[model samples]
Target: MRDNYREELDDIRGCLVDMANSVGSQLSKATTALLDADVTLADLVIAADDQLDATRESIEQRCFTLLARQAPVATELRTVITAMRIASDFERMGDLAEHVAKVARMRFPDSAVPQEVRPVFLEAGHVAESLVTKAGTVIAKQDVEAALELEEDDDAMDRLHRQLFREVLSEDWPHGVETAIDITLLGRYYERFADHAVSVARRVVYLVTGEHRINAAG
Candidate 1:
């Protein structure tokens, strides 16, 4: 019975890793849809978010079941609880990516991003993708070093976000009101997506070492 319970815990962990991977893939496609203004692809991304929702729900159910049945202690308790928290973050990440796809779909034929700032958003997308993938690996291995490094990776996204503000706020900006709103919203979605991934990594660090590291920004 004890051996079976341990296997169940491992299965729950596996589910969380798969959830992270799915969110990362969705983010990649969502960014492509945003940059190219592909409404069809955007629509696909938006609709598929339900998959993430289901994954999170399944994870939560398993976690609660463990808490009720096994009464997991110490690291085992942390494992169940942190899986729930990380799964929530994973679900929110999906929602952020969906927000980006919605903006791309709303603009339809016209690209949501103007040509001048196209490179900035493209870079944002790249960084967001990299952060989530790295976050997943940290969870899989519970590597405190890798988990700590996510903050630095997130810094690159922050720099790009501020760069976006400079572009939009400039007096000579040509995109005007509607494009400005799109760009602002798009930038936020990317930034928040990365933030959620960072949160997940922090939780993983806490689960492994029992110390929740403070974020420099916080």
Candidate 2:
């Protein structure tokens, strides 16, 4: 029975990694759709979110069953708990990406985004996609060092988000108020997406070091 439990635990870890990859793909596509103003791609991102949602649910169910059956202790306990937490974070990341895709689909033909602000949005999208991809790597490899680097990359997205807002507000008379609002929300979505990826990376650091590096980072 112990052997069976051990196998199940490994399976759970694999499932979590799979879930992370799924979320990463969704985020990448969603951001791409938004940047390219590809409504069809945006629609695909929205549709694909359902699969991510299902994957997370399956992972959570297995985690729960393992806890109930094995009553895991020590490292096993830590593994199960971390898997649950990680899956939840990945699910939220998927939701945020879907939200960005929605923005693309809704604002197409005349994207609410101003021509001048396009560069900022593009930069934010690129950084956000990179962060999510790196996050998947850290989760799969348990590379605490790589996870630490992701925290710094997150700063670029934050800076771009702030600049976008500043530009929007500074304009004495903005064109297409609706488009401005959509772009503002879209920028914020990307910022928050990176923030969640950082959260996942922080969890990886803790899982590897048993120390919460989030607060320790100065």
Candidate 3:
């Protein structure tokens, strides 16, 4: 019976890793849809978010089931709790990607990003993708070193986010109110996406260390 309980805990960890991979894909595909101005692809990305939501719900339910039946203690309890938290982060990450795709769909047929600032969003997308991918690996391996490295990796996304604000607030800005608003929201979406990835990494760190704290950098 204890062996079975341990197996369930391992499966929950696996589910978190799988959810992270799906979220990473959503971020990448949303970025492509945004850059390409392809509403069709954007629509596909939007539709696929349902799967992310469903997967997270399943993970959360498993957490509850483990708590009720297995009564995990100490590190094992931390494992279940952190799995729920990480699942929430993954769900939020998916929502952020959907928001980006919705932005792309909103400005369909023409790029939502202005030419001058396109590179910023592109780089932001890449950084988000990189961070979440790293977060997934950290969860799967529970590597404290790589988990800690997520904080440093998030710096790239933060820099790009600041650059975006500078562009939006510049005296020479010429994209008009609509584009500026879109840029502002996109900047936020990407920033939050990176934060969610960092959150998952931090949880993994806690699972390993029993620290149970959010990262300071975030």
Model 1 scores a TM of 0.97
Query: Which candidate ranks first by TM-score, i.e. highest?
Result: 1
Query: Regarding lDDT, does 2 or 3 come out ahead?
Result: 3
CA lDDT of every candidate: 0.89, 0.81, 0.88
* Predicted candidate 1 versus true structure: per-residue lDDT over 1-218, tens digit per residue: 67978999888888888888899889889989988989888999999999999999998998898899889788888888989999999999999999999988988899989998999998998899888988889988888899888898799999999999999999999989999999988988988998998998999888878887838342
Expressed as tens digits, the lDDT of each residue in 115-140 for candidate 2 is 77889877877787788778878877
Give the per-residue lDDT digits (tens) of candidate 3, residues 5-40: 988888888888888889989989999999999899
For model 2, give the 10-residue run with minimal summed lDDT: 209-218
Clashes of each: 0, 1, 0
By summed lDDT, the worst window of 10 consecutive residues in model 3 runs over 209-218
Ranking by lDDT: 1, 3, 2
Backbone clash tally for model 3?
0
Query: Residue 159 deviation, candidate 1, in Å?
Result: 0.2
Better of 1 and 3 by TM-score: 1
Candidate 3: C-alpha RMSD after superposition: 1.3
Which residue runs of candidate 3 sit more than 4 Å off their true CA positions?
212-214
